[model samples]
Target chain A: GAGVSQTPSNKVTEKGKYVELRCDPISGHTALYWYRQSLGQGPEFLIYFQGTGAADDSGLPNDRFFAVRPEGSVSTLKIQRTERGDSAVYLCASSRTSGIPDTQYFGPGTRLTVL
Target chain B: DQQVKQNSPSLSVQEGRISILNCDYTNSMFDYFLWYKKYPAEGPTFLISISSIKDKNEDGRFTVFLNKSAKHLSLHIVPSQPGDSAVYFCAASAQGSGTYKYIFGTGTRLKVLA
Candidate 1:
């Protein structure tokens, strides 16, 4: 893809439901990241992937919020037992280089609304 | 707590005038700062960035200035145009060598009125 692509631009689920959001990073990009943005706030760090392995998952709100990138090119962010508070825009970004100093390109994001 | 802060919630500028947006960060470890512009229903688009090492960077009509000692950064747009009206977000990252999980400031909404 020419840019980072995210699936299901919007999702509405009841509390306790499970949801999966997908991201297809740009070809050959070595780094991927996930972020959450609540109403009226900026994107908050959720997780980061250096390659096939997650380099940082500390930002995940809890164990219920998990993400994975089985192949270095694509990633999935899964949320289980979704709470109303979990409602927010889940954003995905990718960079050619894995790490901080690189410019990341972001996707349109999935606006998950937990009703 | 928000590590990155954009205290001004909104700014109104006249067309053909300059617009200045400011941001501040409490984390000294951030090695780089970036500004993104967003329109309604669209994802943010990268504008300009400045490294912690340099005080300023210029790109056409957009310029970014970083003050490491003050932990502050600012974006200047020359001859602000109505099309430039959008929400601007400032982001900072710590340990640029490892991850790009940046801390972003609450966006500042700028309206350039003609």
Candidate 2:
């Protein structure tokens, strides 16, 4: 079975630019999550979606960050006015369901560089 | 504040020896703990997990031990192999608290010398 997949394995943008990262969760997975990893740091949770609705977005750093999963399978993470501080790897993950003890399957992260 | 902390940044072990990675958490609400292994330019892969209700969980060469009273956990790999070298992350989640999000530690780099 195919694991989670993220498009644009690498993205470079200038400061103040806008970028969108895409994720394709595993088939039949009802839960999707987004996280960001800074250099030498563990992944920080961003947002999560259960089915088509975002179950939690408290981890989103600021208003510039937003995510959506309209069809319940593919998700998009949008960032506005990119900042150098945002340079890091964005990761996506999915599981069978939400709020359970299910293990999460991760995708190869998309490394985003802000210059 | 970091809810999950992997105090050791890196560790090296000889092949056929035991590799132990430790993690601590400040949030007592965390009831589930998981270990993940990641290679460069790759996403993390689930390794093993232990529930707060159990003191230890073993799977093949990997074993996870939890100390709820100490708010600590350790992952031990017996007869470490060179292929086991990678960054290890410990994540904690409070499933009963209605939060599905996981809090991950900084990560520990483990090097297994053959």
Candidate 3:
């Protein structure tokens, strides 16, 4: 069984640039989530999607960050005018069902470095 | 606001010993707690979880204890193995109004010595 996966395991970009990170959730998963982890810190929630629409986007830091999941199985997180403070590992997770009890399986994060 | 906190940044214990990882939360709304383990360059893996209604939940060698009064939870690994060594994160979630979200701690790195 394939787990949640993120492409471009590592990305390096200059400040003020734009980048898009993609995530492929596990087969049959209906719930998706995005999180970011900084050095020496645990993952911070970014956005959550239930099916094709975003159920929650409160975790997104600011206008520079946006995510979309049109097909319900795949998601893309877009960042505009990247800053040095944005350097971190972006993680994606998915679960079989919706709610608090369902276990969310994670993907190997994509490390983004702002040069 | 950091609702969940793992004050100890790191912990070390020898194999065959009991490893205790502590976590505290400030939000009283949190009713479910979970533990996750992660290695370098990898995403976190779910370990075990306990609900606020129950004080303890055991799974094989792993046990999670929750103290609602103190808003504290601890994960105990009996006879800890080197393979168990990793960064442990504590997560809390509240269920209400049909909305759910998890708050995570800063994480505690554990080292199991052989």
Task: Report model 1's TM-score to 2 decimal places.
Answer: 0.97
Q: Per-residue CA lDDT of candidate 1, range B8-56, in tens?
A: 9999999999999999999878998999998876677889888887999
Candidate order by lDDT, highest to lowest?
2, 3, 1
- Runs with alpha carbons beyond 4 Å of true place in candidate 1: B96-99
Stretches of model 2 off by over 4 angstroms after superposition: none
Fnat for each predicted structure, in order: 0.67, 0.82, 0.67
* Best-to-worst ranking by DockQ: 2, 3, 1
- Write down the TM-score of every candidate: 0.97, 0.98, 0.97
Query: Residue B12 in candidate 1 has what lDDT?
Result: 100
Pick the winner on DockQ between candidates 1 and 2.
2
Measured by DockQ, the strongest candidate is 2
Candidate 3 residue lDDT tens string, A44-86? 9999899999998999999999999998899999999999999
**Interface RMSD of every predicted model, in angstroms:** 1.6, 1.0, 1.5
Flag clash pairs in model 2. Answer: none
Model 1 chain A worst lDDT window (10 residues): A96-105
- Identify the leading candidate in terms of lDDT: 2
Which pairs clash in the backbone of model 3?
Answer: none
